[model samples]
Target chain A: MNSRSWFRLKQNAPKLSMLAYMVLFFIFLLGPILIVVAISFTETEYVAFPPKGFSLRWYERFFEYDAFVDSFIVSVELAIATAVLGVGLGVPAALAVTRGHVPFANTIMTFLLSPLSMPLIVMGFALLFYLSALGFGVSFLSLLIAHTVISLPYVVRTVAGVYRGISPDFEESAAVLGANRLQIFWNITLPMIKPGIFAGMLFAMLISIDNLPISFFFGSADTNTLPVVMLSYLEHQFDPSIAAASCIQLIVAVIGLFIVERIYGLDAMTPAS
Target chain B: MILKRSGITTVSAGVVSPWWIAFTGLFLVVFFVLPIVNNLLNTTELATLAKQRPISFYYHKLFTDPYYIRIVFDTVALSVGVTVICIIIGYPVAMFLVRHSGKWSGFIIFLLIAPLLTSIIMRTFGWRVLFARRGLVNDFLIWADILEKPFMFLNSASSAVVGLVHVLVPFMVLSIASVLRSIDLQLEESARILGASRVKTFLKVTFPLSLDGIGTGFIIVFLLANGSFVTLLLLGGGDLKTLPLLIYQQFTISRDFQFAAAMSNVLLAIAVGCLYLQLRLIRRKGVKGS
Candidate 1:
C-alpha cells in the first residue's frame, strides 16, 4: 500500500476497533430479543432459533389462549389506571416539593422517590399481606394500589426534574395579572411541563405493564398480568406462543419509548443522579 | 386585596396548596408506608404467636441457620460479581458513547434503554431461548468443535450472572457516561500536550474523574442484583438459592408469611443501606459540581 494509505489506516485503527466493539455490544443486547421474534414465527411445535420456516402460528396461538388474552387486557387496564393514579398523586407532590416552600424539601423528595430504590419483590410481599389485611384480598384494587406505589416515583422524579428547569417568573407574572392559583397552574405551568407530565405518565404505564415481581404476588385468575401468566406458563411449558407474547410486550415498550423519544428524549429518562 | 374584587384571591406565586401535600401524603401513608410497617408488625406478631420471642426468633434463625447464612453470602457474591462485570463491560461503552459517537449518540442511547423498558420476563425468556438445551449457543459451540456435546448452560449460576449483567449494564453505562460528559475535555488535551500518552491520560485523568460515576453505578447495580430473583428463578434451575427466591418460595409454597417477611426485612436493609450510600454519592457530586 502507499504511504498515505498506510498512515490513514493507522490513524483510523482505534475508531475502527471501538466501532467493532460497539457492534458486538449491540448484538449482545439485541440478539436475544431478535431471536424471540424469529422464534415466534417458526412453523413448529417447539421453540427453534434459526426458525424452520416463517409462519404466524404462534401469533394465532397467542390470540387463542384465553389466559394470555385476559391477562393482557388486565395488564393494559392496570397500566392505564396506574398512569392516571401515579400522575394524579405524583405531579402534585412533585409540585409541592419543588414549589410549595415545604420544609426539608430535599428529605421529602428522597422519601417520595424511595420506592424506586426498594426491592419490588419485598414490596410485593409486604403489600400482599397488608392489602389482604385491609380487605383488598388479592383483587384488582390491590393490584392497582401496589402498581401505583412503585410507579409513582417515576412520575414524581421526571416531573420534578423538568419543573426545576422552568423559570417561576412566568407564574409570577401571570399571578400579578390576576390569574388565580388554579388558573395560573392550568394556563402557564401546565403547558410548559406538559412534556414532563407526558413522559412521566408514559413511564408509569410502561413500568406498571412490564412489572413482574409486584404482579407476581397478586396473581389470581382475574388479576393475573401478562408477565405473571407468561411466567407460570413458562414454568410448565416452552412454546413459540411464549415468544409471540414476548414480542407483543416488546412492541408495546418500543412504541412507548418511541413516543418519549419524540416528545422528551430518552437521555432525560435516566434516574435522577 | 385588589384581586378579591375580581374573585381572584391572590396567592403566593410558587406556593402550591397545602392540600396537595395532604392528599399525596395520605395516599403514600396508606399504601406505601402502611404496607411496609404492617409487614414489620406481622413479622413480630407471627414470631410471638409461634411461641418464640419476636426479634430474637429471627435473629436466632438467621445467625444459626446455615441455609440462611449461605443465602446471604451467595446474594452478596452474586451482586458483587455482577457489578464488577458490568463496570468492566460498560465503562468502555460509556466512553464510546460520550467521547467517540458524536452524531450516533441518540440511537446508541435508545439501544441501551430499549431492553430496560421491555419486561424483565421477556428479557429472561430471550435468555432462555438462547440458553435452551438445543439452543443457538450449544449449536454454535458444537459446530465450532468447542464441545463434543451440548453443555447445560441454563439453570446455572454463570447464566444468572450473564443474564443480570446484560440487564444492568445500561444503568452503569448511563451512570458513568453522565459523569464522563461533565468532565472537561481540555484536561485530556492538556495532558496530551504535556507529552502524556492517551492511555496514561485516561488512567490518570479520565478514570479518576469517573470514579464518582463508578461508585453510583456500583451501588445501583449491586442494589438491583441483590433484590432480583426472576432471573435466578427462571435460569437458576433451583441450583441458585438467594434470599429473594427463598422469599418467593416461602410466600407461594409454604405460605409462611412471617418467615418470608423476616427474610425480606434483611433484603430491605441491604437495599436501604445501598440507597443511603447512593444518595450520599449523588449529594457529594452535586456539592462538588456546583
Candidate 2:
C-alpha cells in the first residue's frame, strides 16, 4: 500500500504543479488581456470587463465617431508607411552590417540600435525641437520619417540576425557558379531572408502603431496617430472611449503579431527586440 | 588556392563602399546626432533662466518642497520596490521555465512574451478595469469578505507599482532565462552528484551563472521604471507624480519649456547613465568571459 501510494504521488506531482502554475500565470497575464477583449464587445457606455449586457455597441459607437475613425485611418496609414520606409532603410543597413566589411561595424550596429537604450520622453523632446527647427512641423512626412527612424533599429537587428543564418558559402558558391551579385541576391539571398524582412516589417508596423510619446511631438491635429489621439483624448476626457481606443490598437497589434508568427516563427524576429 | 582575379569579386559586386558609408552615416547624422544637438541648442536658455531665478530659491523650492521632492522620492522608492518584487517573483518563474519547462518552453515563452504584443495603454486600461473599486478584484475580495469596504487600489501608489512590475517582469524573466539556459546543465548536475542539495546546488552553481542576466535585467527594469509615464499617469490618478509626468506637466500645463528641459535632462541623465554603466560592465565581463 505504501509503495503503491508513493508511485501514484510521483507520477502526479510534476504534472499537477505545471497545471497549477499555468493556471496562475494565465490568470495574472492573459487575465488582463481577456478582460480588455471582453470589454471591447460590451454594450455599456462605460468600460466594463466581464462585460455587462454584452453587445457590439462600443464597436458601433467607435465607427460612428468621425474623429476616432479619422485617427484610425491615420494610424493605419502611418503603420504601413513606416513599415515600408523603415524596412527600406533597415534592410540595406542590416545587409551592410552583416555582409559588408565596414569600418567600426560594431559601433555602427550599436549606434543604429541605440533607440532601444533611450527613454521615450527624451527621444520625444529631442525630436520635437529638431522637427520644429527643420520646419517639418508636424507634417505627415515628418511623422512618417520620425516613426521610421525609431523603427529602423528593429528591422536592422532582425534582418542582421536573419542574414547571419544565410550561409556565407552560399553567396560565394553562387558567385563561383557565375551568378552576378544581383542574381545571387534575387535568387538566393532574398528568398532566404524573406522571413526576416517580414518579421521586421511586422515589428515596425506594431511599434509605429503603438508609439505615443514621439508621435505626441511630431503629430499635429491632422497628423496624430491613434495612440496620440487616445492620449490627447485621455488628457481632456477620461472616459470609456479612451479605453475603447486602447483596445482597438492592442487588437490590431496582436493581429499583426499573429500573422507574423504564422509567416515566420516569432523566435526569428525577436533578435531586433 | 589559385590567385586568379575573377572579374566578379565576391563583395565588390555586392555593396558599393561609398553607398554603405553614405547611407548609414547620413542616416545617423540626421536622426540621432542632429536631434541631440538641436535640443541642446534650444535649451540654451535653461542656464540663463536658472541664474535669473535665485539659486537658493530653486533649491529651497525643490528640496524643502514636499509636493515636488516627495514625489521624486516616492517615484524612486516605488520603482526600486517594484524592481525588487519583480526579481523575487520573476527569477523563480524564469528558473522554472528554463529548468523544468522542456517541450512546453516555446508555448510558455509565447504566454510570457505575448503581453508585449499589445500596447502599454491597452494593458493599463485592463488594469484600471480590473483594479477599480467596483471592478473584478474588489468584487472578488468583497465577496470573500476580506474587507467590509472595498480596497482603494485605483489611482494609488501600490497599484501603479504593481502595473509597472507586471509590465517589466517579462523583460526581467526573458533576460535572465535566456542567459540561464546557456549555463551548462551539467554544472548543476555535477554539484548535485557531489552531494549538494538542490538548494545548495542552485545557490552555488546556477545562481552565479545567471548573475549577469540578473544584473542586466535589474538595470533594465530600474531605468525603464524610472522613465515610465503611462502607468503613472493612468493609474496614479493625480495623487502620485513621476519625473516624466512632471516633465509633461511643465510643458503642457505650465508652458515652462526651460523648466521642462531641465527636468528632461535630469530624467535623461538617469537613463543614459544607467545604460552607459550597464553596457560598459557587460562589455568588460563579456570580454573576460570570451
Q: How many residue pairs clash in each candidate?
A: 0, 0
Weakest 10 consecutive residues, lDDT, candidate 1 chain A? A264-273
Estimate, for each residue in A55-112, the C-alpha lDDT of model 2 and write its tens digit: 7676677778877889899989999999998888888788877777777777788788
RMSD per model, one decimal: 2.5, 3.3
In the range A15-94, model 1's lDDT, one tens digit per residue, is 99989999999999988878888888999998777899889989999999999999999999999999999999999999
Q: Candidate 1 docking: what grade? A: medium
- Give me the iRMSD of candidate 1, please: 2.6
For DockQ, the strongest prediction is 1
Which digits, one per residue and each the tens of the lDDT, describe model 2 over residues B1-290?
A: 24324534644545323255457657768977687665555443444544455334544565578886886677677768888888887887888888788898878888877888777777787888889889889999899999788899988877888788878888788778878888998898899999999789989999988887788788778877887888888887666787788877776677666556556655777777877877686687779789
Weakest lDDT window of 10 consecutive positions for candidate 1 chain B: B4-13
lDDT of 1 by residue, B1-290 (tens): 65553443344525466457678888988998888887777743455544454665775797588988988889889999999999999999999999988999988998899888877777788898888778888888999999899889999987888889989999999999999999999999999999999999999999999999899889889988998989999888768889899999987788766778888888988898899898888799779879
